[model samples]
Target chain A: MNTLIFRTIAPFLAALMLVFSVFVLLRGHNEPGGGFIGGLIAASAFAIQGLAQGVSAVRRALKMDPLGIAAIGLLLSALAGFLPFLGAMPFMTGLWIDLNLVADTVPVSSVMLFDIGVYLVVAGTVTAIALALEEKETD
Target chain B: MASTAAVSPALLEQAMSIAPVPPEHWLIVAPVLVPLAGGAALIALRHRPGAGRALVGRLSILLLALTLAANIGLFLMVVEKGALTMVMGRWLPPFGIAFTADRLGAAFSLSAAAIALLAAIFTRGEAGTGAPAYGPEPFHLLLLAGVSGAFLTGDIFNLYVWFEVLLIASFGLLALGPDRAELDGALKYGFLNLAGTTLFLVAVGLVYGVTGTLNMADLAMRLPAMEGVPAVTLAALFLFAFSMKAAAFPVQFWLPAAYHTPRASTAALFAALLTKVGVYAMLRVLVMLMPAPLEELSLLIAAIAAATMLFGGLGVLAERDLRRLPGFVLISGIGTMLAGIALHSPGGATGAIFYGLQSMALMLALYLALFEAARLAGTPDLMKGGGLYARHPLFSGLVLALFFAAAGLPPFSGFWPKALIVKAALDIGAWWLAGAVLLSGFFLTVGLARAYMLAFWHPQRPPAPVGRGPQTGQAALSARPQKLALTTILPLAVAALAVIGFGLFPERLLQLSGDAASGLADPAAYVGSVFPGAKP
Candidate 1:
């Protein structure tokens, strides 16, 4: 259980994975990566932290209850689906809002919000299960 | 509605290019979305104790009421103008995820929302009666969302997803009580239903593989044109899986075993809604997509119906627990629907659909009545709780009406549907189906009457100790045996009135059910509504 090398590298590895996860989540709408995969990556980061330290450390790092995070993610994803309803469209119809930056204008769609929500949902669910198992073993 | 083009010309163009979304399409998804969103929100606020749970609980009920209103609106719309169809994300049919609200789906959704609203209210009484793991408000919301989604979805895979959603929620509800019996029941319920859904998924895969599409309308268009045997096999797979879920015949064992394990009101909701959903799926898929195969399998279907009816009768006769008796009665109700469905006549289909809705109300009323009856006698055993008719006339009266209705007696909601089903059977010259229907009704009457006599009309007997000893909050029920809370009274009244309303206006229900059946009989209208320009 006392692997200094794993503990030392865990933080750096988790941090890198989290960054990569966000990158994947953002690109999910247009390309190969999406919320599900990105969330898995982020979850693996937390899982690695749990293995290196303990579930309490992972909980401290996340700074939120995993289930609460999952619930929020679900609400956000469902909210994304609801946006189109305001536009008088069918459920989950993609609606775009244009964001104008100083340099260029960007089109942000509800689909992106949906993807991020999925990412959080996946990450939260995985982290929750992993932490629960870790805690169970300690008990 | 600002002209965003003034700010950015290109953005305006992009926004304008999106088609003017039909305002009615929002109604189509409201039933599903309201519950989904509400459930997610409830889950987020789940950690909040007393006030939080209570607030969310009321909000969830309010949302269910809203969904029911939407369902009524959707039903009227569909009744006025055939089926309503919407494609998610604007993709065309066979390629897009589609949702279609036909009369059947609308009716089932409305009934589900109604049952859920009452169940949410009933849970107020049972709130702290079980393990906190029940997650009552959020889980109930999720369950309603699943039921609505299942009824509303037009794609086959989406139906499977909805099934999983409800199944998961049911598992949580089923295991809520602290009794080890609840866990045992949950395990059986869980594994059997998991296997059923798995089989359903496999059938969906096979059907998709054969037709290269999952849309119900697309499948209808392509299925008859493709090889016949594989299609028939797929239909049979659906029959098996849905039958298991419906707790029909050989598969009916799980219902009584698992159903009685939950808290009474929860068991009422399950009895009221769950198997009927399976029945709805069977009616939708088999009758709509594979009519020819259904004709071929009519004999098998009839046999299953007969067996389900007979088994249900025997189960009711054998069941000693008052709370559990309703579970077997529910099985009998499923049998009645199956018999109606097996006849494959318009009258039969109408009867089945009508009975499905009626039984939903009646079964819930029966369970709630049982809850009241047990509250009066301080026990759940039929043999122990006596002298109820002498004491609480109103409770006994409601229980009598529901029981008679459950037994398919005349001047009740159950009679009209049974009449339609029996007439259909006779018309189709299916003597066995007709005989089975009548005989099941007879057995149901005898069995229920026996339970009634033992529970209410018999000489007074000292009540047995309840499964859990006199609990704190609900313990007040036995103390105040002479009066019932309006919270408890309201749902039962709503359910009883719905039954009587349907019974008195059988023609209206018959017309709606008839329209629903016709849609199933000739899916051309359903398909056309989904694919407006496509040549049938």
Candidate 2:
């Protein structure tokens, strides 16, 4: 599985997939692509990288522990849920803001933050599990 | 004029009843969100060098204390104003999720949070000083959050989500111990509980399919009007699934197989809260949502309760491992609670609720006491345990009080609930059930007395001198007397005192349970709280 051609292309493929994952996550508020699917895509990308470049390379690239990332994601999601409280709204009520650029208005919402948190949690947990399995195989 | 003629009076009433959200509405969700946020923050900080066991332990205790306070406030609010509801995201009920707290839910949540707080304190001593970063603390808080959510959720599907949350957290906790036994037990617990939740989901689906709604209050309004086989079948499915979760009678094998393998503190938390959630769900669904079906199935439920009590008591008598004994005792207590549900009277419901609350405190106390006693004895096996009474009179006395409470003796918390159940049974002319309740209590007394005699009364022989032949590790460990830590004793003593205090002053709990039961029997207020302005 660790052929020269695959090893050479895996990093660029993984990078492209990560970028695509972020796009998918960002568009999820009104599209079919969301945090869950985006996270899955990124996780699959990590799996591919692990398969080609090995576990250590993937681990070095990731930097933080996957579980810690999942924890931060959880905290972020919880914080997003709490944001509505500042406006005296109910828990999990979505608050929106419009970023008025010179040429266009980009709509942002607490819902998006919540989705990103979900994205990180899913990606981190799945990557952690997959990485653990891959390392176990070599041992 | 035509539009006015087309509208129903109930619809018009509901339209006009859209009152502004009250200021105290946030209290409805606080019990759930507080622990959830706390758990997430703790996990995020878990890898930091400063996040030691002591910090995690105190943080967990504080989080649970906050949850308990929230629950108390919610309970008071519910008591003062009837049921309280918080519809998520400003959406009306029947479309949005609702966190509704009636007497029963609030009381159960309060008891669960209190016991969880006590368990956290007990864990402080059990985890020992300077242990590695407390990985399980976050899961513990998360578990309580799930439990609180389950108690408070007003939507059936939401209840399933809470069950999953608690189940996942429990899986993490059950697997925390280093022993291979922990893994094995976790597998059994996980598989069986997952199956139970799947069954619950199927039941939820069927209810939604038949009734066109998932809001429990809406279902309560709609279910009774629907007739016949579908409703009864749904009730049976719910009963079977929740029975498995509650570890009652036939599906009860998994609990005893799994509960004894976890760390004692984890076991205590499971004992106090997990099955009680199942019982609470049963009370809400069977007694509140579908009374006709429950009545139709009362004979079957009563039989299950009787068998559960008998078998649980007999299992206790047959068991030798001290750690495992509480599992059986817990099952027996569940049977008593089930008996209350089976009776289906206001008195019966009162008994069930009261028994459930006391059982939570009692089980927590019992497990903590046993954990300490086993530490002093150097083994959990009853056969090798003895002389605790000679050396530690206070500890022995505490255990005795807990035992007395467990056996439903007078002047202890267990007695009142059992008495209520028996009277409810005899009032309904269910002589056999009344007899079963009494017989089970007797069996429990005998079983616990045997445990006390074997573990505390039987004198231990002096340890074999070192350097003579080969000394077994158990003997070497038993040679040195183990002192009870103050952290350990303080929580156990507090729990014991709470049990004794409840037993001595049963009036307040009795009144509360009575009100909770009456509220279940006639859920007009609960339904009104959910729908706001809808006519009952």
Candidate 3:
């Protein structure tokens, strides 16, 4: 039942999708891209891997429980939101830290961190579902 | 596209120049945020089972205690300072999400946390998240977060979000223990509640469309000047949605069918907190936000209240299963609250608030008592065994107290609120409503008394004549503590004590509930606090 072509190209396609997901995640703060979209892309990469190899293969590749990853993402986002409390601001207030990198000064915001957390949560949740479905179908 | 439109540059500039509001009050968000953070942390540790179970249980208790303390402090602050409003990320009212801690919201939040804390402690004793198959901590914490959010939110859309959070947690909790019947119950519970929430979303959308605002305070100000029909329809929609959630009349079939399927502790927590949140939302939105429409529909609401009470009382009479009887009792309690709402008097509303709190305590105590009684009787069916009064006087006493309190007997916590509601009904000249309340209480008492006779007083063996003790062996009081004594009996005793305490000193509760009712009756303070310069 294995397709040779799908097995051959799955890893490369997954790599490309993973990289593109990060691109979408990074620009989500000010642009149209977002954690949700980025996570979908990453989840699609895992879905492809699960399809090409198996559910077990995808689990081995992730090296962490999907639900656990989702939990971490949720915690990260909450921590990002709570960071403003230290500054005596309301919850979910955006905080920025400017980093100087040799020739350039870059600004990083907690909003972006929250976006990343969302991305991880979305990816983890969707991938978990996909793997479960695939595993169930096989059984 | 043809560029023929003349756009206003000033409008664009005005929109661009609006700055986000600076954060002024940091403490306002603690009710929702604390539980969210705790839930996340608990989920993170979900995979590691049993090893750190005790530590996690302690941490959960500590976290809930902190939340309760913080909520009580916030409630006091709100009462002292009017309303505490926080606009998320400094956005102004009607634009950014608003979290307001008014008298009603704060009191409900505090009570919710208190119930959750006690439930958590009781659950820990039963078998905390330490048990692999029972009591997932994250869901419980998330459910608390959602309930807190529902009370604290000042925006309707945000309330929907919080409902989802709680609903998801509840679904997990509902299906937690192993019972094949639970699947059927969970399905019904899930679908009906989902339909209710869906209706709520549609109502929210309609309300937003008409008033151009989702903020509760802003809507209160804007809604009156708008057309009446849509507002009334929206009110009806809210009534349907919230009434379904509260499991009142006609729509209440789901409660008895499903509530008893969960583990006893889980059912107790659900019985205590879930429907009350729905009733709280109804009191907040339907009565406070849309008072005119509710008044217009008072006769219809009163009719429904009567029917709900009748149906619930009949169900209790018809039920033979001991565990399922409390579910009907819960439905009957919902009807009593609805009857108060139907009266639309300040007295009626105050009675409703007081009754809501009393029901929260009594329902938990009743379910926990059922667990103890069943443990002693060796069956969930009351007809199978008897003479609990002779064998286990302490537990039988607890059950009697809870039953009397629930039946609205004199000098118990339930009596004062029922009296207030009855008086309010008579004052409003809704004699039928008053009759229904009394009749329902009568039926509840009769039914419970019969159950008590069958389960506790009547023995399979013939009773000894006159004042002699039964020959079912001596009343043995073991020096050693029995199993589940700490886990089960302690919480039930505490709840019984609270009921007694509420009865002894009803002043503080009455005063607080009166203040909450006053706030609900008049949204002026709430509106003014939210919109500083808006004309009434």
TM-score of every candidate = 0.92, 0.94, 0.91
Model 3 chain B poorest 10 in a row by lDDT:
B471-480
Ranking by DockQ: 1, 2, 3
DockQ, all candidates in order: 0.53, 0.49, 0.44
Off by over 4 Å in 3: B1-24, B49-52, B127-134, B460-482
Candidate number of the best lDDT? 2
Q: What is the lDDT of residue B281 in candidate 1?
A: 96
In the order shown, the chain A TM-scores of the predictions are 0.93, 0.96, 0.96
- Check candidate 2 and list the clashing pairs: none
Point to the candidate with the largest DockQ.
1
Residue B56 miss distance in model 1 (angstroms): 1.5
Residue range B66-154, candidate 2, lDDT tens digits: 88898888888888988988877656778778889999999999988888888888787664322376457888899999999999999
Error of 2 at B469 (Å): 17
Estimate, for each residue in B395-477, the C-alpha lDDT of model 1 and write its tens digit: 78888888888888988999999999999999978888889889988988999999889988987786445656543423544
Weakest 10 consecutive residues of candidate 1 chain B by summed lDDT: B9-18
DockQ of 1: 0.53
Worst 10 residues of 2 chain B by lDDT: B469-478
User: What CAPRI class is candidate 2?
Assistant: acceptable
Interface RMSD, all candidates in order, equals 3.3, 5.5, 5.6
Per-residue C-alpha lDDT of model 3 across residues B445-492, encoded as one tens digit per residue: 999998899889987434224434331111221112335557567778
